[model samples]
Each structure stands twice: as structure tokens, then as C-alpha cells.
Target: MVVLNWNGADDTIRCLHSLDAAALETPFRVLVVDNGSSDGSVGRIRREHPDAEILELPSNLGYGGGNNAGFRRAEEMGADEVLFLNNDTVVDSGFALPLLTVLRGEGGAGAVVPKIFYMANPSLIWYAGGEVSLRSGLVRHVGLRRHDGPRFSRPGTTGYATGCCVGLRVGVVRALGGFDEAFGMYAEDVDLSLRLRAMGLRIVFVPSSMVWHRVSGAFEGRLLRKLWLRTASTVRLLQKHGTPFSVPLFLLLLPLRLVPAAAGMFFSRLRREESV
Candidate 1:
């Protein structure tokens, strides 16, 4: 498991503890990569979980760089599959086995994501995989903010599996050159899954394997910043995959990509006005 930490010591520590206490029987090692944090996150993780390997980077590599570093190290260490998980998440009681089971059983599956819910309220979903419309540049989280239900109980193919808690077959990922670090952070998972799909591989969502995410724990309330980063990543996706019309498609879909965030801000303003 690779947990990327950027000045998020508390959440990283909690995530480490949760993984250490997981019910899965697989022998594994956690690699906590400190993306040039000044908050002493590396020291804390080392002191708290001496068993985990600490990779202290000299500068912030962003999410893609950090995880790719971990992935390369994991490959060298003979890891058949690598789990790229966020430091602000808690693995469900026995998360690994279910994910592995699906990845192995599904004939063409190259990766899988666990069902994710909000850490603040475990009953509410944060992600359950997502559906993306490349034509419209619209992506929507499956069951976003929705309560858990029977509707999400089965394993299924997803447009993309989130990076927050996803497992990938190392050999395949490495062959494809790992994740495109240009993504920096946002939308990297989507880009990876799209590549796998284009290559005729599957990305599965395993609901039985669950995780809870502290949504935006490390960078809360920075909507505008995240929006631009994600937008830039999506644009790159078009340039990389949308052949014959990449530039024009990017221009056409740019504003559509911001719709959800814009709608969110619009409603937030209305609520404040009503309360006033």
C-alpha cells in the first residue's frame, strides 16, 4: 500500500493505524511517501508505525509523482499489485481480499476501486466509482453523497476508479508507464482508467471492499484551486486521447466541466442569503 502524505500527519497516522489493524491476512508493507512536507509527517509516521517504509521526498511531487515513486519502489520490491490509497482514508475491516478477489476473477480487469464513503459519516458515499462522458466532458461520482443501499452492493465495471483507494496490477501499470505525472493530482485516476479501457482492460468497482475518505482533508475549502487543477488535467486527457478533435473538444467542453462546481457555489450563496 502507498499512502501519499503532504503535511497531513494526523490523517496519515490514522490511515496507517487502520491498515495495520485490518482483518485481511495478506502479508503486505505500507509505504508512506512524504511529498516534501514541513509538518514532520515523515517523523511522525516513522515513530508511530515503525514497520512502514518511509520515503522522504525532497520536494512536493504532487499526487501523481508521489504515487509513481512508490509504485516504482514497489515494483522493484516484487509487488504483484499495488494499492494507491490516500492518507486521509480508513480501510474497511477486510478491504483487500474483496478487491483482490474481483481483480483476479474478472477476466480483463486491470484495476479495482473499493466503495468509498465520507469519513465524517460512514453511511454517506463519497465515491462508488464514476461515469464519465468524454463527449460532454462531464464526470459524476456514482452514488455521490448518497446513503448506502442495496443498489451499490454488487461489483461492476466503472467508467473510472478513483485514486483515493484503488488497486492496480503492477505489471500492467508499469508497462503502460505508470500514471502520467502531468496530472499533478486531480483526474489522474480518470486518465489511467481511460487508458486501461482504451487498451481493452477493465476497471472494476468492488462494493464489498470498502473505504472511507476524509474528503478534502488535506486541502479543504480550496474549491477554486482544485477546480483549475482538475480542469487542466481534463484538458490533458483530451489532448492525449481525443484524436482528430482534441483541441476543439477541449475548448468546447471547458465550461461544461465547471458546471457542477458553479452550481454548488450558486446554491451555497442562496442558502447564506436565506439564513440572513
Candidate 2:
């Protein structure tokens, strides 16, 4: 398993603890890639989780670079598969086995993702499966904010596998050259999923494997920055995979989509300031 950390020591340490607690019948190792965190995250994580293998990068390499580093390290360590997990998530004890089983049994599967729930409200789903529309340049998570139920329990092939907690076949991903670092952070997962699909590999969703994510924990209190990165990455995604009309359509609908989100953030900040 690979968990990328970027100046978020507390969350990373908690994630490590959860991994230590996970019930996996197969042997595995945890690789924590520190993305040049300036907050002394390396020292803290090393001190807290002595058994985890730590790969320290010189500077913040964003999401793709950091995970790419971890992928390489995992490859070097002779791992057949790699699970890229977010630093702000807690996994269910049985999460690992289901994803591994599906990845191994499904010969066409390039990647598999576990069902994700909001850590703040564990019953609320964050991502069950994902869909990417090249026609509209939109990436939608199936069952977002919905209550977990039988409808989401079925394991099947999906359009995309979210980076939050996706298990990947190392050989397949390495041959595809890993994630496009040009994406930096946002939409990189979508780009990877698209590439995997283009290669005739299925992106499977295994609901039996589950995780609880502190949604957007990396961008907490930084709404504008998050919005900017997401917007830029979305445009880049459209350019790479969308039809010519898709980019134009996305830009045309930008204001319709962005304005309300920006307004909500603005009001939210004002309300917080007033409360202070």
C-alpha cells in the first residue's frame, strides 16, 4: 500500500494506524511517500510508525509525482500490485482482501476501487463507483452523498477508479507509464482511468471493500485554491481526452458551474468570520 503525505502528519499517522489494523490474509507492506512536507511530517511519521517504509522526496511533487514515486518504489520492492490510498482515510478491516481478489480474479481489470464513505458521517457514501463523460468533460461519482444500501453492494466493472483508495496492477500501470504528471493533482485519477480503459482494461468497483475518507482534507479552508486546481485540471483533461466540442462546451458552462460554488465559499467564509 502507498499513502502520499503532504505536510499532513496527523492524518497520515492515523492512516498508518488503520493500515496496521487492516485484516489482510496476504502479506503486504506500507510505503509512505512524504511529498517534501515542510511541517516536519517526515520526522513525525517516522517517529510514530517505525515499521512503515518512508520515501522522502526533496520537494512537494503534487499528487501524481508523489504517487509515481511510490509506484516506482513499490515496483523496486517487487510488489505485484499497489494500492494508492489517501492520507486522510481509514480503511475497513476487510478492505484489502476484496480489492486484491477482484484485481487478481478479473483478468481484464486494470484497477479496482473500494466503496468510500465520508469520515465525518460514515453512513453517507462518498464514492461507490465513478463515471467520466468525454462528451461533456464531466467526471461524476456514482452514489455520492447517498445512503449505503444493496444497490451499491454489487461488484461490477466501472468507468473509472478513484485515486482515493484504488488498487492497481503494478505491471499494467507501469507499462501505461503511470499517471500523467502534467495533471499535478486533480483529475489525474480520471486521466489514468481513461488510459486504462483505452487499453481494454476494466475499472472495477468492489463495494465489499470499504474506506472512510475525510473528504477534501488536503484542501480544507482553501476553497479558492482547490477550485482553481480542479478547474485547470478539468480543462487539461478535456484537452487530452475530450472531443473538440467538449472543451468548448466545458468552458461555456464554466460560469454556470463555477459561480454558485464560488458564491457558496464566499458566503461560508463570511459566516465564519462573523462567528469569530
Top-lDDT candidate index = 2
Q: Candidate 1 — worst ten consecutive residues by lDDT sum? A: 267-276
lDDT of 2 by residue, 1-276 (tens): 999999999999999888888835545799999999999998899899877799999999989999999999999999999999999999988789989998998469899999998776679788999988888877778987789999988889988889898998888888889889999879999999998898999999999998998777787689879889988999999999999899898878888878866774565455435543
lDDT of model number 2: 0.88
> Which residue ranges in model 1 land beyond 4 Å of their true spot?
243-259, 262-276
Model 1 pairs in collision: none
TM-score of each: 0.89, 0.93
The lDDT values for all models are 0.81, 0.88
The per-prediction tally of clashing pairs is: 0, 0
Give lDDT for model 1.
Answer: 0.81
lDDT of 1 by residue, 178-268 (tens): 8888877688888888888888998989898989887776555566776777777777776676665665776686776578666654443
